[model samples]
Target: MLRLRLVTWDVKDTLLRLREPVGLSYAAEARSHGVQLQPEALSRAFRAAYAAQSRRFPNYGRAEGLSSRQWWLEVAMETFRLSGVREDAVLALMAENLYRDYCNAHSWELLPGASETLSCCRRRGLRMGVVSNFDNRLESILLRCGLRHHFHFVLTSEAAGVAKPDPEIFRTALRLGGALPEQAAHVGDDYSRDYRAAREAGMHSFLLHGHGRSAGPEVPPGHVLPTLSHLLALIEKG
Candidate 1:
């Protein structure tokens, strides 16, 4: 069996995900503020805005000393501006509300089998923790989702000062767990960010490809899994 002392997880799209399309959420919130926005346009604008913000101020601008709130507000303003809404006051208020709204269970849902898998791991006496490329609000989000108690710690990109695809974040997690690289494994949905990067950090890695999700041919079959439930089986068999 693979000797696993700790199992670290990526948060979004792995353990949990947004309840609805982000654009739909944004549109509904905007409507509440008396601004009409097409969900589709808002979606596209959001994607573009998010990408631009990430490139300009990666890891929520930790290196530049920008708080997560400040960075997200910038993204929200840019998204609204791109969607043809230019009122600064309206954008500010909507962004604030949107940011607050997202830091709770209402905006997110746990993936199928997530809770059961975590519970199983806990019963097996495995140390569990979160290693996510998320903001500092991750703890709050997990708490509201009733998942906080399952983890020994939650390390976010904002807190770590590094993002996935960079091995340092994984190293930070290993340090937190007080385990060697080979004694830990990481699970996440992204091929590059979760699998390859974690392996490069000298840890075991599993790329989660749930039902109907694709694990590109480039991925080795041994490292690809269908869900968190499969992960426990694989760990046992390893």
Candidate 2:
């Protein structure tokens, strides 16, 4: 039997989802600064920019040595090129809106059975933690959602100084959780960053689907499950 030591989870798009459309809050806040933006249009632009930035990080890390936050800010700034918004102003708006949304308990909704699956892992005596490619505010988000108590450790890319698809972030999580790479597992929705990187780091990895409408690569995950609750059966079988 495989010795299960730690169970690491991803944050955004995995455990919790945004309660409202992206930039709805931002647009509201931006209106105060004399910037006119419709919620839906701003939301679409922000999401497109976010996804594009995420895709560029691995490449930028491999080449220009850019940090995740830096990458994101660049993308965010570029997204406002047509709006005639100043760089400093755009960044301030983003920071304010992101923190406001994350810290607001009503702005985040937990995934179906996320709490139950985590409780099952705890009951099984498996050390549980979170490893996510996110900014510093992830801790506040977890606390706001009452999930801070569930994880033994929380490693954000900003804290780790590296992002996913890079081995250092996963290695740091293993060290923090006191688990050998082989004894740990990572579960997330992104196939390339979460599953592929965890597998490359010698951890068992599972891919979660059905959260959003994004079309992912055709490659299969080591274990495929539609919801977090299904992970319990996979661990039991193993």
Candidate 3:
């Protein structure tokens, strides 16, 4: 039987998701500053800007001396610039609003079964922590979402100096949990970052299937969970 003691979770898209589309949020911010941007266009531009920023400043630029807020401001600026908003003043205003707006719980919603999963883990005497490629604001967001108390610790990429799929973050989680890799399990929606990375780290991993979405045939049957509720059975069986 698997001796599961620690369960580390990936936050974004795993435990919680944005309440609205990124583009809608960004466009709202733009509108506040007298700019009208198509939400779809802004969303696409944001994705591009975020990817470029990640390549340039991985882990929120922790090693490069950029604070989380500063790094995000850079991403926002790049996002606006890519979407054809060149005015520095306007870019700053929009980005600043976005940064502030996203920090609150209103910006995010707990995923289905998230609370029940955590409560079940707690009932099973499991220790839980968060392992995510997020910035310092993660704790605050969790707190506002009323999920902060469920975790023993919250580890972010900015705090760890590395992101998921690097393995170092998983190692850090092991140290925090005081468990061997085999004594822990990880669950997340992303295959490479969460499932594969955790498996490579010697822990059991599960890829969460989207609601009303089917798992691809390529995924191992046992490793893809239909919902967080399925996780309870895994723990019980183990």
Candidate 4:
């Protein structure tokens, strides 16, 4: 029997999310400036921008503290740039506005039943920590959702000096959990970042595919648990 003592989690999309698709927030913020762009387009652009920014600033947390906001501003600008907003002035304006808008707590909410899952883990005596590719704002966000108490520590990419899928962040979480890789489990929604990365780090990983099933012959077997409730059951049974 495998002994498990620690459980580390990814924050965004795993524990909580915006009430609507992220694009809606982008659209809403853009509309205030008389900008009319499709949310779908903006969504794609935003993801691409964030990914690119990550590659450019692979060691953000080690850099100046202001790097967080600067990185986000770059991503926001890239979103507009990809959306066909060619004017530099307009792009800068949108980036600043959108960055400010995202900082507000009104833009996010806890995922359904997430609290119950965390509570269940607590009752099971599992040591929990958080590993995420987020900025400093993440601590405040978790606190607002009443999840701060459940986690023993929160490790963000901006603080770990590394992000997910890189394995460095997972290593940090393990250190915080005070367990060997085999004695801990990692949970997240991203396949590569959470599943593949944790698997490579020698930790058991659970992929939570919310709202549907995604298993296929090509997909790796025995990792998709899909719901926090199922994850809790597995940890409890172990």
Candidate 5:
């Protein structure tokens, strides 16, 4: 029998895949303000700014931090500057609309075998939860994706006041789910944020290798599974 008490999952890039082109909505909004930007250009600028802001946020147990929405707001503003879009109001509106859409958007595809694996975990009597580095709107997004019911606890960085790579985020999930660290497992696509933090917190860690080759000196030593099904098999075997 499996010894796990809880199974926690990361949100983006692990369970759900974005279906629509990211910048298409931004491009449409830009056009409304008489600005013309290639979608690819906008996407690149947005990604760069987003990553920079995330890095600026306090790592681990710092008191000061930006919520995912606040961080993305800065990214959107900076991206507007990078794209030479001069309208502040337009940028703000786009940011608000895009975030709202993201919460309610079904423009995503759940990964193959994800539902089956989750169901199997549930049937095995393992309580499931989510510990994600995201804004307050993460619950709404999960609900829209029909995943809200699957998780007993959903902790976001905004709600927890600590982001991943910090043991506190994982601890919070354990506390909320009434599971000890040793009785849990965390699976995510991020090596540093998920694998390293989960293991440090005394939980088993699994790196879900999705898209992109593994790149980084800080990648953790853990089971690297290509698909959610593989993880399910490991859990079952344990």
Candidate 6:
């Protein structure tokens, strides 16, 4: 039997997703302030700018690093510029509003069945925590979504000073969970960061699939689940 003592999770796309497309949120907010933008265009531009930021400051809220607010302010401004809202003052107002919107829990929704699966894990007496590349706002998000109480701890890239695939975060999570790597399992949607990286860190890993998109730089998964409920089955059967 595959016995384990701890199980950690990834936040975005694993436990929760944005209530609306990030670009759409920016576009709508900007529209309310008299700045017109195409949501699709804003989304594309946001993705590009955010991707650049991710590459540049993957863990921006950590020590001596730019805050998440700063990083997203840059992304929001880039998104505004790309979507034809180039006025400096309007861009600043939109960026500030967008950043504030994301900080609140209202911006996210729980993934289908996430709560049930987590209840099952807790019922089985597993120590759980969150291992995510998200900024510190993750705590508020999880708390507002009613998922925080189920975890023993929550760790984010902001606090860890590194994102997934950098074994340090996983190691730190393991320490917090009081489990050794071999006795832990990680669940996430990203194939590289959640599955392969966890496996590489010497922990078992599960990939949340069937969400209509797959993360890149493929790798062999320890397990693939179409829904969160499937995870409880796999663990119990093991």
C-alpha root-mean-square deviation, each candidate: 1.1, 3.9, 1.5, 2.8, 3.0, 2.1
Residues 118-231 of candidate 5: C-alpha lDDT, one tens digit per residue:
888888788999988777777888888888888998888777877888998998899998888889999898888988899999998888886766735565333777788888
Better of 2 and 4 by lDDT: 4
Better of 1 and 3 by TM-score: 1
Which scores better on lDDT, 1 or 4?
Answer: 1
- Tell me which of candidates 1 and 5 scores higher on lDDT: 1
Best candidate according to lDDT: 1
So what's the TM-score on candidate 6? 0.93
Clashes of 3: 0
Best by TM-score: 1
lDDT of 6 at 135: 76
Distance from true location, Cα of 53 in model 3, Å: 1.0
Candidate 5 TM-score versus the reference: 0.87
**Cα misplacement distance, residue 82 of candidate 4 (Å):** 3.5
Estimate the TM-score of every prediction: 0.97, 0.80, 0.95, 0.85, 0.87, 0.93
lDDT of 2 by residue, 1-238 (tens): 4578999999887899888766676676567667787777766777777677667665334346675445655665655543456668666666545555556778889999888888888988999999997777788889989888889999987777778889789999999999999999999988888988999999988888875634255534428777888898877666
Candidate 4 residue spans exceeding 4 A from truth:
59-66, 84-90, 211-213, 216-222
State the local distance difference test value for candidate 3: 0.89
* Candidate 3 lDDT tens digits, 56-162: 98888898999989999989888889889999988888888889999999999998999998998998899999999999999999999999999999999889988
Better of 3 and 6 by TM-score: 3
lDDT of each: 0.92, 0.77, 0.89, 0.81, 0.80, 0.84
Report the C-alpha displacement of residue 118, candidate 2, in angstroms.
Answer: 0.9
Q: Supply candidate 2's per-residue lDDT for 188.
A: 92
lDDT of 4 at 131: 91
